[model samples]
Target chain A: MIAPLLQGFLDEFERLEAAMPGYEQAWLRQLRRDRLDAFVTSGLPGRREEAWKYTPLKGLEQRAFALPRGSALPPPLPPPLDAVRHRLVFVDGRFAPESSRLPADAEIEFLPLSEVFRNHDAAARFRIARLMGSGEDALDHLNAALATDGLLLRVPAGRSVREPVHLVYLGSKQSSGRAWHLRGLIELEGGARLRIVEHFYDGGEEAELSSVINEIQLAADAELELVRFQDMGARSILLSRTRLQVEARGRLRITAIDRGGELVRSEWLTTLRGREAHGDIAGVARLRGRQHADQVVEVRHLERDTSAEVRFRGVAEDQSRAVFTGTLHVAPGASGAETRLSSRNLLLSPQAEVDTRPVLEIHHDEVVAAHGATVGQLDPEALFYLRSRGFSETMARAILIGAFLEEISIRLPEPRFAEWVSSRMGLDHPLPWGGEKT
Target chain B: MLEIVDLHVSVGGTPILKGLDLRVPRGEVHAIMGPNGAGKSTLAYVLAGKEGYERTRGDIRWDGKDLLSLAPEQRAIAGIFLAFQYPVEIPGVNNAYFLRTAVNLKRKARGEPELDAVEFLRAARERLRLIGSDDGLLQRGLNEGFSGGEKKRNEILQMLMLEPELAILDETDSGLDIDALRLVASGVNALRSPERAFLVITHYQRLLEHIVPDRVHVLAEGRIVASGGPDLAQRLEREGYGWLAERRRASEALG
Candidate 1:
């Protein structure tokens, strides 16, 4: 009894299964078939499901999207970055080698997923098999069953990458009303350090649906900083999830800026698996018009002396709605684990909506956990103060909005990344403080 | 010159300023003293064009221009400034940036050339030095984590930078030490000019001792109950405002 909405995707997958990469490999074929069966059994999660209660898929299920094909010219990259040493470009979820600047260094191994499948790399196959074997839900299973291409990056032990590796996902409207799925994997060995910047943009004007899942694993003594900027077309829908695993003494920092897309659901699931592991997630979602953005985060501390912090800010204007849900869990016997989570949102209009929920579950007595969520409008006192200082009403509102999300910009590793986030959020005031002069 | 005649103000449908009248000519500093609930702050807020303080039946004229029709920012650009008793602490907004933006906005409104960051910084540093203060406050957030005295000084610093023609000090001496009081007074004294006027609102005569006023007016029952020279502030300090209501009743009975 598969739902008619997902029947289209199932049919499309069956039709293209034979041409998919690694189709001839028995194990890969079995993995895809099993995931497809899982997807069929559990269609799209409905409101009845606790995790999907705030998000409804009726708008996405109304229309069927065909697989994107044919190469279109990639749009010019954003300014403020004068040099990019290493970059991987994906057009419509398929790797575009022509637009990528692949690094030839010996300190790391970076390759497209299709290339890995073509070469029949044993280790790559094992990693992919393991990732697909542990599917969380319907969306994860669907991505596993259909994703054809993404990136695979691994940094060896004891090596620190000086420059950040840029990963660009461009949803081009060469052929309209299309859909694409991608899977990415990144691993840092013991004592390795790396920084990755991920950008999602729409190259043209058409409604496209995209889903991406990424797995990032940090070994002992490893550190990784990830910055993501998602600014796609106003009519596009995006579903993305990132799974993070950290070993002993490993640190992972994530800054996600989501200010685009008509309907977006972004999730991050992180697990501190070893002793003394640390992870922090900080992000901002600025939405206006009729856009809907949802950010869900879950962190699990499984070892002693682990710590996690999750801070998110949301600004919704017009008829837009923003939703944030954060959960922190400390496993039994995970003593001395500490966790803090907060979600603060600002509604700019009477019709705008914001919903936030922060949850904490500590099984160990020695564990420390705190969580808080607030949904409020801009401070009237702050606004009046700015107005009294000769700022126009609109200008005062903009300044207060900028200040509300200022902490996110300060946490950004690169100044250019901060500038990009500011521009997307329409915070381009003559800020006398940071960024270039207008 | 600034003038207010038969000014009646209400807040939430309750009258605060009932038939208040005041006039301050250019080149004169007038100190306004009052007890609590006498609408001393209300007058300040109304003059600065704050919202919610409705002008039910009143007319305020600033240099012969109607002032009630203007917005708060417009009134600021029109050369009126109010030093709030509680200066707002805006975290994440640098002090230098906020002041520079304010200075530039007023300048731009007057069709004057704008100052760049460097020029503004130099001017701000110079002012900071003249007020016997350090430049570190400029780099920090606008009054964030500042002490009570520091916050009062910040309000004075803004007044120095803005250089308003009619500067209204709304209890700026409420939460300051003796030294801070002198520092704030000096900052205001430096800007006193024949082309500018000061409307100093206070509850005590100590601030008046440093920034001496040409005239003193006692506001009671939302109206000027008494007006005299600088000696009036001293008499009130010694006698207190307990006699103000009785004195107002006596005057009304005589009328």
Candidate 2:
């Protein structure tokens, strides 16, 4: 039964292949077939896996999702549109280029994944195979089996792109158990530098599931900074994963912000492959009203003289729940490797729950590796100080929350993205004092 | 400007201040000198309306208005400032921002125009220079990682910005060098006016030399045992509180 369903999913891949009729390559088609086969064998992860224990796949069993059929896109993008330098809109497993704005500079290469498969077959195959779900995980396999529309960004060698690339993923309107598996491949050549921002938004109020996978590879002396924003509606379920590989002297910085969703889980796995490589992973999750947000990150220091830092902050209000699990690994012979993982959670309501865990796995004896997790309410002293300064109790709480999250916000490479995240967290308005929302 | 009549306070069910009376009319700087555990700090905290200090029996009045009934912040807005002995260190809150909030709170209460950043900076710069402190201190969190002298100077800087009608200095001289102490004292002396009053609490006569208090009161076992002119501080410095405690014991024995 699973074989046929898996084959049916692969059949959809053939359709995507046929859609790009003008440019078809045999090697690219074979590689996609091999990846689909890998997905068929792996299937969905079960309770046995430690990473998938807390998050079960019970809801996924109840429905079968089909690929979206039509070319209907979402309404025109919202205002403050100038904030995004470039945008690629994907509606129901298909790219909507008409709704996007690309930069004029030819140094930064941006195209639909389908186009990349047709035009740049070798580059696409090498990136997808090396960065995609080569691990022994079921969800990753499922994503590979049913992957459709997404983005492909490449920064040429010795070139530096000034603006950030934005990828906007929009879910379909139908209530079908349809899953939109989208993947983004960001390839930075040697001595290349770029910044990319990916946003996943759902316009419809229908119950649906969408999983997005992003793979980034930084060549020698290459640098890349990426930010992913997930702000779907309450009826949507999103499972997003990103894997990054940095080579010698390469630098990769990633920030993930989760604002709204019924159930959202994102994982980041970064590996430092060569000497002097650096990876910094930071994320913030704000949840309210029965929402669930989970972020898992792992940083591996496989070579000597490598350093990494992972920081995660979450605010849970109403009946919302948030979970953060961070791990830092330093392999043997990876001396002078310094890695730190810190996670802080703020519970805004009595019913709100936050679970944070930080793990450190070190096989090297001469390395500095530390992990810390703190879960609690706001500091009473700080709150009282703010209130005593003429701010109401509500304003006091809001200010302290902003202060707590400011540590991460200040580290954002882009100011506009930081402001956008702050606004989503309700830090834009003056705090409502005396139980009145202003 | 402020009156503490027969004030008694307790902490953790233990009596600390017993029927201590103090009156500071406008235009005078009164200093309270005593040894450790003499309830000097307690009096300052109680006057500032800090919680955790139970007032067993007392009536504190400011400008003929009952003060014990108000909250600490309310008391603060009413022009009662207490320079803490051991200032609390708050990390991540900028010093300039904290002072701005405090000043704005007082200004709004007084129905005065609040200063914006530019206006506040111009005024604060003068005050900071007057205290012999640098502008970098204003960019850091409140009292965080500050030296003892810097903390006391920051307190005086706050007083200068707020310009409270009545000020209480609780051991402001405890952790200062001679120069820092003189600077802090000069900062306080600059704010002395006929409309303002001060209650200076200290364990020694070192700071008194700078401000030159009009009267000095000695507090022992939670009550005032003696009151005299500035010479009393000189006498206490020479004779020490041991002789006074013996005389008080002898007087109690005769009674």
Candidate 3:
């Protein structure tokens, strides 16, 4: 029975391959073949694996998901960027080009993953091999086998892109029992700088599962800032996995803000491969109404003189649950490496729950690595102090909660993004500090 | 004007102030010098309505109203201020912010207009400089890292900012150096007016030299054992409270 299901997935994969008539990338063809083979052999991950303990894939067997139709293009692009830059909008795993906004920048290159595979063999092969790896996870295989449209980004050396690149994935309209497979690859050459924002939104009330994979490579002295915000509607299951590699003197900062979903899980894996590389990861999850948000991060310092910091804050209210697990590993001979991981949670309601686990694995003797986790409610004395100053009880509690999450929100480079997150957390009010409200 | 009639207080179910009686008319500064464990601090806390210090049998009237019936914040609006001996350190709460909120709370309660940030800053800066402190203290967390003398000076600064009608300096000069003591006393003196009354509680008579009092009382065993003029402080400083305790014991035995 499982073999036929696998075969059915392969038949759909073949249909998608035949539809792309002009694509001629040999390496991508080979990568797809290899991934399919791996999937046939490895099948799906079992519950015994430590990483898959909290999330299970048993629901996939209950129903078969249809391939997204590519007939309807996306709506009109948003703004001025619609002129120059290339755009690829995915709706339920199908490509929607009309809704994308592209800008005109010399060093900027954006294309569908199929085009990249057909034209740029070396880059396409590198990205595919890097993403697939040797792990035969069912989700990875399924994504490779069934992916309809993938977004590809490339930035040349010594060039900086001012306008932000946007990739938006919208689910099917009013469709239930469907699934989406999204694959994205971003490459930054030496001395290159890029800022990208990706948003995942859905308009349907159906039950759907989304498996997304993003791979980022930062060359020497390159700088990259990526912001990923997910606001999928209720009755949705999303699993997003991101892998990042930073070279010498390179910098990477990623911020993930999550809200509005029944069960959303995000995993971030980063490696500092060269000396003096820096990576900072920060995320905030606001949940309510029985929603569940899980964030798992793994940062490894593989060379000397590298540093990484991971900070996560979550606010759970109204029977919501949040889970955070951050692991920092320092390889041997990685001296002078400093890694700090902190996870703090605020529980606003009695029934709401938060689980935080911070782990540190240090093999180097001359490194500074520490991890801290805290989960609690607001302080009573602080609340009383604010209330005594004429602020209403509700406003006082909100201020205290906002102050607790301010440290993470302050790390966002853009004021608008910071304000968005603050407003989402209900912290845009004037706080009682320094005599005046802030 | 304030009156304390048969004020009795206890802490942890142990009586600290036993049938204490005192009265301060408007615009008068009365100094109460007491021996150790004379319930001096207890009296200050009871008047300020701090927790853990319960007034079992007492009637405190302020400005012709029952003061004991009000909460700490209400009393603050009614023009009562307590300059603590050991100022509490509230971390993460900026000093200026804390003071401004307190001042505004009292102002709003009295139907006065609230002061904006710029106006409050100007007024606070002038007051802080007048008390020999700088604006840097305003940026720091409220008394978190303050030295002993600095904490005492901050208490006086708060008293000055709040400007209550009935001010109680509870050993405000306890841990100050000579310069700080003089600065704090001068600040208190600057705030003294005919429309306000002051109750200065202290262990020694040294503070009296800077801010002279109209009357001095010696408290022993939770009650006023002797009352006299400024010379009484001098006499107690010389003779100590050993004789006063002896006389109190003998009088209790005779009764």
> Each candidate: RMSD to true structure?
2.1, 5.3, 5.9
* Residue B3 shift from truth in candidate 2, angstroms: 3.9
Chain B TM-score, model 2, reads 0.98
Docking class of 1: acceptable
Fill in the DockQ of model 3: 0.13
| Top candidate (TM-score) | 1
Candidate 2 DockQ vs. native: 0.13
Candidate 3 local lDDT, A71-181, one digit each (tens): 544433333224434345777765566566565544587777655545655656676556545335776777775564577778989789876676777776455666667
lDDT per residue as tens, model 1, A1-438: 545557778778878888888888888888889888888787777788888777877546657787765666777777743367778889888998988885677367888887776565677778877766665698898888888888888999989998888889988778777889899889999989998888888877688889999999999999999988888878888999999999999999999988756789999999999999999899889899888889999999999999999999999999998989999999999999999999999988899888898888889999889998888888887877888879998888887888888777677666666666676677765342263321
Q: Judged by lDDT, which candidate is best?
A: 1
* CA error at residue A438 for candidate 1, angstroms: 17
Separately for all candidates shown, the number of backbone clashes (residues 3 or more apart, or on different chains) is 0, 1, 5
lDDT by residue (tens digit), candidate 2, B30-88 = 99999899999899888877668898898889989999888777777888888888777
DockQ of each: 0.48, 0.13, 0.13
Clashing pairs for model 2 are B1-B26
Which whole-number lDDT from 0 to 100 does residue A48 have in model 2? Answer: 75
* TM-score, prediction 3: 0.75
i-RMS for every candidate (Å) is: 3.2, 7.4, 4.7
Query: Between the candidate structures 1 and 2, which one is better when assessed by DockQ?
Result: 1
Best by DockQ: 1
- Candidate 1 lDDT at B72 equals 90
